[model samples]
Target: MTQALTLARPYARAAFALSREGGRTAAWSQALAFASRVAADPQAQALLGHPLLNPADAVGLLAPDGADEAFTRFLGLLADNRRLVLLPEITGQFEELRAEAERVVKAKVTAASELPSAELDAIKAALKKRFGREVEIETAVDASLIGGAVIDAGDVVIDGSLKGKLERLQSTLSQ
Candidate 1:
């Protein structure tokens, strides 16, 4: 995993620089996401390293509409280099760069059960205030949490889940 990310960093950085300069960050984001999904598909995965597959065919498979000249060229380069498998990692790093540039942070919120919109909105508001940036919340329900929620915002983790509290208490008692 780490190796893949390391290999993908330069490609992601180059793509990000191009998109930033072109003022087409969102378009590039969509294109990368689409290409990543295509590359991740089972059929595409099988074809990635096939000796007989043409680079143009691979690029066409991943980007049917040819989003733009730069993106098409980028896809061709990846296809030529047999680096299609790295699309997901590249897309992720690109998104991180885009988010940082846009002053947006993605927060993963895990709760015991589905949270109401009002509660989610309140959490978003609080997180926005805390991070001083736009908060994009992605929520999931984990019954094992028992109660409360856990907010994972990059380096900051607020473990309010009952399971987390119990674990901390147990650790303290053990010490």
Candidate 2:
């Protein structure tokens, strides 16, 4: 997985750069996401590395209807290089780049129970302040958390759950 991500990074950056230059960042993002979904299907996965697969056919399979010429060419390049299997990783990195450029951060919060909208709003506000960017939050309920909540904003994770606190306390006493 790490090797695939390392290999996909350059291609992702190249795609991002081209999309930004062409002023088609959003379109490219949607197209890449579509391609990624297509490549993720089990049937498509089986054919990605098949010796008899044609590059054009690979691009045809991955490219969405009415895909722009440049985007299709990019898919063609990946197909020719036998790197089409990396589409999912490449799409992920591309979205990260797009999000960074747009100054948006995505966060996930898990709590022992469903969070109230007011609490979720507060968390979003705090994260926006911390990252100095607009924040989009997705929430979930995990009963194992016992109490409190966990906020995961990519590089930052704040684990304030009762379960987490008990584990930490146990570790400290053991040490």
Candidate 3:
């Protein structure tokens, strides 16, 4: 994993520079997502792992079709260098660049059940007030939580779930 990430870093930095220059950061994000999905296919995985498939053939298999020339070229370069397996890391770096430029933070919320719009609105309002930034929230349902919700954004995690509270109480009593 470390080796893959190290190999992916330079390519990601180059792509980030191009996207920034072309004012197509969002486009790059979409392109990276599509490329990553394509590269994640079982056939692609097999081809990537096989020592018999040379760099050129690997690139041909990975490159995107018409209408996405620049992105296709980027994928081709990665594949030709036997780096197609690093798509996940490349995607991560691209997202990091986009997030930094957009000043956007992604907040993930997991609740015992789905949150109502009103409750989500309240949470959003409080998060906005606390962080003083634009936040894009993604919510999920986790029945194991039992009740309440957990919010994780950047380095801060506000866990206010009944399951978490009970676990803490259990620990305390045990201690």
Best by lDDT: 2
Order of models, best lDDT first: 2, 1, 3
Candidate 2 per-residue lDDT over residues 25-69, each given as its tens digit: 999999999999989899998998898999999999999998899
Better of 2 and 3 by TM-score: 2
Tens digits of lDDT, candidate 1, 48-146: 879899998888888747488888889899988888899999999999999999999999999999999999999999999999999999999999999
Clashing pairs in 2: none
What's the CA RMSD for each of the models? 1.1, 1.3, 2.1
Alpha carbon lDDT of each predicted model: 0.93, 0.95, 0.82
Clashes, model 2: 0
TM-score, one value per model: 0.96, 0.94, 0.87
Superposed model 2: Cα runs more than 4 Å off = none
> Which parts of model 3 are misplaced by more than 4 Å?
50-67
Could you give the candidate ranking by TM-score, starting with the highest? 1, 2, 3
- Cα deviation of 23 in candidate 1 (Å)? 1.6
